[model samples]
Each structure stands twice: as structure tokens, then as C-alpha cells.
Target: MVDQQWTGVRRRVVALGARADSGQVFGSLGHRWVLEDPLSAAELAELEAQTGARLPEDYRDFLTGVGAGGAGPAYGLFPVRRVQGRWRWEGDGAELADPSMLARPFPGHGPDPESLAALLAERPEEEDFDASEEFDDAVEAWDERWEAVMFAPERTAGAIVISHVGCAQREWLIVSGAHRGTIWSDCRADDTDLAPLVDDDGRPLTFAGWYTTWLEAAELTSRQ
Candidate 1:
């Protein structure tokens, strides 16, 4: 049974979700979305066991009470089964996160490059390489280290791809760790960097905040 509060939220969501398929919600941007059948309790449990990660409460509620797929921001919410295949990053080499790291908790804080700096300093120079080549080689080596830090479990860990916002931009829901339940934007994976989706107050939007905010916008826009 869905809780009273989220049941209300889900009702609003269902109303707004209908507009996604009609193309009125997004105003001819042509993004389409639809809600699928909700996942059975058994199915959700099986999904968690298979992935070794527990989902956040609100998202889990959405999946169980509302629908497992369809009718979401951007392209749409992916089915839970899609996680198995979406484990790898398609955007860039620097933001890689694999299936193995899904259960880990996301670190509350951002990247810590101090350890990476020390690790790089300990690496020995390449043997018999010319100055230019060696410099290039060293730079390449450092780049790898930098990428590692960016994608470290604390940085990119415990996150699952939730949806793609087109143009190679994507969204992830933090399933474990400190930021669990927060929605993150991966638009910068190939450019600037990953960022949390924030509200007008600059607070990172939790799953409920992100979705409800969109629903509110959709309602207001539809009225206009």
C-alpha cells in the first residue's frame, strides 16, 4: 500500500504524466513518456538482490505504487531491469561507474585529489624516453589518475542511471551512500562535470523534490 503523502504525490504525478504522452507537457519539444505497470513486490525485491543495492524509499515507492517504467523526465524513467545493461557510462571515459559499485554508499562529499596527488608523485618516470615523449607520457599517466579520482566510488559510487536527458546528458539516482535518493545530472560528463539537480534555493533535489518540482512546472505550464 502506498503511504498517504506519496499517494497524493503520485496522484499529481499521474495527472501530469498523462500530459507527457500528449506532447502538451513539454510544449512541442516532442519528448514522449508513459507510465508502465507497477512492479510487484517480489519483482522489486528480486531486482535489489540481483543488483546488491537497496533503492531509496521514494523511488521504490514510485516503482511499486506508480509504475516500473515510463512517464518521467526527459526521455522517460527506465525499467529496473535496464540497470543491468546501463551499468557502464556511455558519456565519457572520465565518469565511468560499473555494476560492481552500485551497492556501495556514495560519499557525502565530493572528490578528494590529495591522495591522487601523492599516488602520482610516487610513480617512477618512464625508462629511456625522450623529453617531449616523456612529458607526454607523464601527462597521459596523470590524466588516468585524474579520471580515477573523478570516478572513484565516493564520487561516482552507488549511483544508478535513471534517465537520459538527450544530447548525451543523463540523470542518476544515488541509491546508496550519503547522497542516497538525490538526483544527479551527468550533462558535464563529456564537458564540465557531473552536478546535482538543485532547486531554486540551491539545495540538491531529492528524488521527491526533483519529480514533484517537474510535476508542478508541468501543471503551471499546462494552464498557460
Candidate 2:
């Protein structure tokens, strides 16, 4: 049943390509979509092997059944082929430059709650510095370590950029760990941690859920 649903969405995605070929815009976001050319299954497998993680079934289906790249939320979907070489993280200093990191499991949770609370409690007080230089230095060292923990790789390990949501917002797909196949919104470009996309019921969205929503949105606009 789910396969049938995915097939329908794939058709919609294919239709977008047809429109693009005919020089027709499907929606406001249509201009942004560079409808993907189809990709071979062998190529998709190579990508999966290189990353050392199984791609989400829906996304795998999209790459082989729909298109290799292009046509998605925000700017457009990133092509797996183009992901080679170093990935420059624009928003923050953290970039998944190492492909080996993609093989690691993605962290299931965000920043640790207890650690965050502790850092908050340790806010340097003006009075603390006046007490002694030694105390101030100690406080500064503690603060630096706390900040590093806040942005540790565990926050978004085993994820790769799948799309650019414009304005430094990036959409990532988890490839490893328990969260594999989930879609996460990385607004760290806006100084925020990577967060999962949830439905009205607050359930974390899967790859299909995220991509299909964008496809449907484009279809609705095409009729307007």
C-alpha cells in the first residue's frame, strides 16, 4: 500500500520534469526546481556504498524511480553525484568534510538537557570576576568547554545535506543510527540546532513524508 502511494508521488515528480521540458512552470517554486535527470540503480548503489549507509527507501526510490537530483523543497534537491569532495558548511564552522563521518550513527537527541542546565547556571557573574583573577580564568575555561559541547558533532552526526532551504537553512537526511531515514531541518545557519520535522501529531517525518509534502505543494500551485 505504501509502495503504491510512493508510486503516485513519483508520478507527480516525473510530471514536473515533463513540464520543465516543455518550458512550463508548475508553481511559484517551479522556477527553483531543476528537475532531475533519471539516475541508474547502479549509481545509486555506489553512493550508498561510498557513504557506508543505506539510503532511505523513499529517497532511494526517488533517486532511481523518479530522478537522481533536483525538484524538492527550498532551492532544489541536491544531486548525490555532486556530493563528492569537501562539503563546505555555510552557516556554522561545522561541515561534514569527512565522508567517513557519514558512516557514523546520527545522534538521536539534541543537546543534553542536564548539561545545558548546568551551563546556564554557570553564567559568569560580574561579581565573580571582581573576586579574583584566578577565579575569572577558571570560569572562562569552563565556559569555553561548555560552548564546545553545545555544538558537538553528536548533534548532527551521520547526516548529509539533501537540500538547501535558502537563507542558510538546510534540510538533512539521516543515513545511520536509529534516526536513519528521518528528515531534519538544520537552521544552524540561523544559529539553531538541527531539528526534526514533525507532523501535526508531532511524529517525526520520514523521507517520503518530507519530500511528498513539497511535491504536493507544487502541484497545488500549478492549478492556481
Candidate 3:
């Protein structure tokens, strides 16, 4: 069950979520996700179950009052914590919590070129996406929680960082090319990727495991 404090937040969310439009971007902590509609009670329950975290307050307020997805007409431009608090317009990312935050252009915080290159070498691709599918669907996409990427749990191994959000098998996240960063699914089953940290199969990976792979690859590459 979601916390009682979140009740007001949730109710406001349920009603407000229903009215949101697609591609509605909102965020905190320099991340983002497009709002679809006000998430239903069932949807909220489902999200909680999936991420193991509760949505935050301003998030509730935004979903219920202003709006969610892409960006709120009010807060969409600045979904930062202070915007909801004393600042109201300052848009502070650090003050916000997890779960409710959305993904956005959080420069200097994600993977770097050398690390990303090392990550790629550590976790090599096992299978290419089918010709029918767009090339960008291979990268893992995370939830509102800390650094995470969703992908298939089988057929992948070594050097990859992965976590299963248990998003339905049919859902696929596209992160490259023309359809870059678009979410999709086959409707047949869960998808998989070669996104560096998660091996060829899409299983959750440990930080140590990822680091070890990078170390080994760096050692080998150094010799060359």
C-alpha cells in the first residue's frame, strides 16, 4: 500500500492524471518522462508495485493540479522542487526525491565517453536488432528511480548494468536513430539489448561486475 501521506497526493494525482496529454515532460534531478494521462488508481498501484517506491508530493500536486507528462502547462517548464516550494520558480533538482521525478537532459551526470566506451567493450552485443526494428531500441531505459534501464533478463550476460522494472514483455524503449528515445514493444514478448552493462541477455548487474569488465577491457586495450 502507498503511504497515507501520499493519499492527498494520490487522489489529486488520479483526477489530474486523467487529463494530461502525451509527450508531457516533467522532472526533478535533471531527468524526465513524458506524461500520458493522469494515472488511474490501478495505474498508480501498478507503478508503486513496479518500482518499489512511492511517488513524491509535488509530483502528486502536479499530477492532480497542474498536469503531468511531457511538461505541465504550469510546472512543465520547471518541475523542480523549489518550484513547488518557497522558490516556486527557482526549480531545484537536488531537493527532489525519487519515483516522481522524470528523465531530462541531466548533463555531466550520466555515462561519459571513456566510461561508455569501456562499458560498450565490457558488454558486447550478442544479437543485432532485427531489420524490421529500429536500431535505437537496444538501449535500456530506466524508471523514475535511480539509474536503471529495462531490458530482457535472458540471453545477456557480463559487463552490463541492468535491472528489470518488469515492464510488460511487449514494451521496448528506443534510444537511438530517428525513433531515438521512443518507447515501444513487440506485443509478442519482452525485448532485450546489448547496452554495455547488461551482458547480451538483460539481467540485473552489479556495480562491481561492471567495473571489473571495464578494468579488464581497459587493460587489454591499453596493451594495444
Candidate No. with top lDDT = 1
Model 3 alpha-carbon miss at residue 32, Å = 17
lDDT of 3 by residue, 12-50 (tens): 333334443411322211222233345455544554454
After superposition, the stretches of candidate 1 with alpha carbons farther than 4 Å from their true spots are 8-21, 27-31, 82-97, 108-154
Task: Choose 2 or 3, whichever is better by TM-score.
Answer: 2
Worst 10 residues of 1 by lDDT: 85-94
Best-fitting candidate, measured by TM-score? Answer: 2
lDDT of 1: 0.67
For each candidate in turn, the TM-score is 0.69, 0.70, 0.21
TM-score of model 1 vs. true structure: 0.69
**Candidate 2, 109: how far from true, in Å?**
1.5
**Residue 166 shift from truth in candidate 1, angstroms:** 2.2
Q: lDDT values of the candidates?
A: 0.67, 0.66, 0.30
Per-residue accuracy of model 1 over 1-224 as CA lDDT, tens digit each = 76444676556655664654446665224334456677788887877876788889988888788777565676666655444534232322324455577798876554445764576565546563568777777768866766676555556678877677767677888888878899988754453357788888999898878776766777787666
Tens-digit lDDT string for candidate 2 (1-224)? 12555666556766765664422333325334565665686676677766677777877777777666666766566765544542222322225424567778887676767766676677667676656786778778876776576556666678877776666667888878889898888775444567899976999998888878777766666655
Better of 1 and 3 by TM-score: 1
Please give the ranking of all candidate structures by lDDT, highest first, separated by commas.
Answer: 1, 2, 3
